[model samples]
Structures are given as structure tokens and as C-alpha cells.
Target chain A: MRADTEQDILKTELWWTALVTAVVTAIMLAIIYAGLVHHINPPSNIETVDPKTLHLTGEFTEGNLGTRVDGSQITSRIVATQFAFQPQCIVMPANRTVTLRFATPDVIHGILVTGTNVNTMIIPGYVSQVHTVFTKTGDLLMPCHEFCGLGHSQMWATVRVVPEDEFKPGPDGRVTCDAR
Target chain B: MALAPHPNYSAQVPPRVDDAVDDVALERVMREVPSGALALSLLTVGLLLLAWFLMYAFVFLPRGMVG
Candidate 1:
């Protein structure tokens, strides 16, 4: 009887161990499949810019800090300042790949778009970039996730994702919230 | 004639009568498999896996592609 009980315990433990291993393997396989098929990955761009002159003579200039279409590529350059994001709002087309580039002239800041996988941190000297495709069409809240200052609580921007037909850029190939 | 007890004498303690029965019960308990515990653990793990899959499918997958 003692030997029987020992065998039963060993069998049960082995079964549970196998089940746990299978569960973990399943999760890992799902993640790998998503990455290979859907191109889902974390944003890890390593580009540098001078924070002192970031706003003076670069792509992050005040006038260039919005969505612009260059040929078939859509890129939005944003500057996360001490308390607010420049432009305050950007417009992009749904179901199209868009590149969001962020830089900060002050302290560290981060942004995450609501209901989307667009999240990145903006360092003073580093340009954070995230390429994503927005499927839903609406004004999604893009909030500053990092605490910058006393006004950090109110630091947020809007991401207006419109339909492909309604995304009409001006002659300069730029789209802004005011244009909508 | 019986000898008289000393002033410091004490009575001997009696042994337990159910000692043999207790040993048998202990062996029986030790030999039994803990099916209830296994069932509970399996149920908890199953629920956790279900929750993870649900979030992955409904929330994470629907959020679209990003890099």
C-alpha cells in the first residue's frame, strides 16, 4: 500500500508538471507566432539628437512637428516638452502604417495611445520612434505617461485616426487637427 | 506482610489503550492519494490559462500591429 501511494503521488506530480510545461510552451508559441506573422514588436529605435537645438533647426521644429506625407510614407514628428506635447493633436489615416517620432528638449517623457499598441519613451537626447497601424477611426487620447512636472497631469494629446478617404492632406502634404 | 509505602512514593502512569488503532489509522491516511488537492490545483491552473488566453485574444490581438 505504501508503494502504491508513492507511485500515485509521483504519477500525479508528473502529470501536473507536464501540464504546466505545455501551458508555458503554448504561450511562448503564441508570442512567437504573433511576432513572425503580425510583425508585432517593441519599439527600440536608437537615434540621437541634440536636445539643446532640437527645436531650433531640425525635423522637430515647431512647423515640422505634425503629420507629414512624403510620397507613400506618413511620419509624425512630435516634441514632448516639459508639460505638453507640441501641436497638441495629429491626424493620420486608419489601416495605414504610420511612423511616430518623439523627442524631448527637457526631461524624460512617455506616451501611450489609447486602445493601441503605440507606446514609447522620449529621452532628452534620443529620438523615440514607433511604427504602427491604427485600425479604429476616432480621436484616441495620447497621454504623457511619464511624470515631467507639476503640469504633467494635464499633458496629453489627441490622435485623430480618420478613414483613408477622409485623410486629405494639404498641398504641402501635411495633416493637422485643424484641417479636419 | 505487605511493606508500607515510602512518603515520597508516586503512582505509575497508565499506558494508552488506542495506540494500536491510532497506528493503523495513520498508515491508512498516509497510503491514501490526495485527489482533492490535485483537483483543486488543476482547476486553478486551468482558470489562469483561460484568463491569459482571453486577454491575448480579445485585448492584445485586437490592438493591431506595432513595432
Candidate 2:
């Protein structure tokens, strides 16, 4: 009887521990779910693309890469190849939805923007996409998180989050940081 | 109750403060509603959640997006 009582007590304590653990885990999951549904968290929509000739044609061409803003729609396309990003910097307006798309022509690369939720892997044959809004106006660093080659340390870009008033596109609806 | 006469304090047996606590004592402690261990765990978890929420709302969301 004594042993049974001791066992019961141990079991009870375990139950309490388990219950608290469950509660904590559930709360964490709920927060993540809310973040995802609200678009405040970084998301990945992986799609395949040709790596051998990404820059030679398609949306990532020399004249096609950059921020394109239409009525309530803004898209930015970039090509990641070798040791540098094709368009080192792209100008975007703060507090607006921006779809950043990336494709790699060589080895794998990962993009991580400092102080933001934009992180995506750039596979050689895949297109990585992330949509987010910049609340603060500043120059954010975009570094190649994956080691590409000898120049991997210097492989970086910039996302110039300009103010709404400062983000002016040409008549052709293209915005580049170089335009400033 | 009558007070006992004082004897040689050093000669008297010393009280054992850290006596061996048996299963009975442990069982008694665990059987109590809102046991101390449970209270401590609850408090820790609550504080952690509070910190997480604060960081998420104030620091993370305000930093904005890649756009």
C-alpha cells in the first residue's frame, strides 16, 4: 500500500509537468500559426526554374530585373549567379507589399536580409519567392547565407526600403536604387 | 505546560536539520493541491510566454519586411 501511494504521487507530479509542457508548446504553435496567417512571418513558395539560362532570357533578363509596380501590385525579380547579385540593390517603398523573387544560375545560394523576415534558399534550378512589407525605411543587407565560392564572403546585396514619397518609378513602372 | 530546566547546551544532543526525507514525506508534498513544484513551473512558463509575446509584437513586427 505504501509503495502504491508513492507511485501515485510520482505519477501525479509527472502529470502536472506534462500538462504544463503541453500548454507551453501549444501557445508557441498558436503564435506561429497566427504569424503565418497574417503574413507577418517569412514564407517560402518554392518553384522550379532553369539555372543554365536564367539570365539569358525570361523575367530575370538584363532589362527585366528590378521592382515593377502596377495598380496594387509590386514585384521584384533578381538573379543570383557567381559572386554577385545581378542588380545589387532594388528600391522599394516602405509599408507596401513587395514580392521578391530569386533564381540562381550556378550553385545553391541562400538569401537572408538583416533585420527582416526574408530568408529563402536559392537552388540552382529553383525559384525562391517571398512577399513582405517594409515598415521602416532603411538600407537592409542581403547576404548570401550559403557558401557559393571563393567570393562568398563578399557576396551581398542591399534592399533599399525607401519612403513612400521617395520610391518613384519611371513611366515604364521600373524602380531601381541606381536611379537615386 | 511547564518549561523544562536548562541543561548543558553543548552536552545535549544536536538536532538533525537535514534528516532523510522518506517516500511518505515526498508523497505528502506531492499530494497537496497547487504544490510548490507545480507553482514554480507555472510561473516560469508564464514569464517565458510573456517575454515571447513582447518580442514578437514590439521588436519583430516593427522591424518590418524585405520589401
Candidate 2, chain B, TM-score (2 decimals): 0.51
Which candidate ranks first by DockQ, i.e. highest? 1
- Evaluate residue A6 in candidate 1 and report its C-alpha lDDT on the 0 to 100 scale: 75
TM-score of the candidate numbered 1? 0.83
- Compared with the true structure, what per-residue lDDT tens digits does model 1 show for residues A1-180? 467777877888899899889999999998987778888888989999999999898899898989999999999999999788898999999999999999999999999999998888899999999999999999999999999999999999999999999998899999999877
A36-80: candidate 2 lDDT, tens digit per residue: 655465455767877777878788788989898887788899888
CA lDDT of every candidate: 0.90, 0.81
lDDT of 2 by residue, B1-67 (tens): 9987677765696876877888677777656644666678779977897898888777766665432
What global local distance difference test value does model 1 have? 0.90
DockQ of 2: 0.18
Pairs that collide, model 1: none
True contacts kept of 1: 0.73
Off-target runs (Cα >4 Å) in candidate 1 are: A1-4, B1-24, B27-33
